[model samples]
Target: MKKVKKGRQEVFEEGKLEVKLEMIPQLLAFGLSIEQIAQGLGLDEQVVRQAAQPKS
Candidate 1:
């Protein structure tokens, strides 16, 4: 049987709002809207959009 692999889990400091910045892409992949992610992250939508862009 084959096993499924998942990304390693990350831990954030308790009582802090900070999350892994790298989660932007994963959240985008999960179909979350830019606005939703931005609002949830307390960041401007433009910053979220920019971060969501693919790197050349």
Candidate 2:
């Protein structure tokens, strides 16, 4: 019998937040609204908004 391969799993790690931060610009450029990106990334819209805040 042939074994079927499962799809890739989404592993959430500590540094994932940083990765998300980096992708924000590209995501925004792609016309993805904050709410959309948040939902797609399994994150809260508020969290995504906070992360998108500019640093002082």
| Candidate 1, pairs of clashing residues | none
| Residue-level lDDT tens digits of model 2 in 1-56 | 12222222223455676798778767888999999989988888888787777778
Given candidate 2, what's the lDDT at residue 18? 72
Query: What's each prediction's TM-score?
Result: 0.61, 0.63
lDDT (0 to 1) per candidate: 0.70, 0.75
Clashing pairs in 2: none
Q: What is the per-residue lDDT of model 1 for residues 1-56, given as tens digits with 9 covering 90 to 100?
A: 12222222222332233443467899999999998898888778887888788999
RMSD of each: 10.8, 6.6
What TM-score does candidate 1 get on C-alpha atoms? 0.61
Model 2: residue 19 alpha-carbon error in angstroms: 0.7
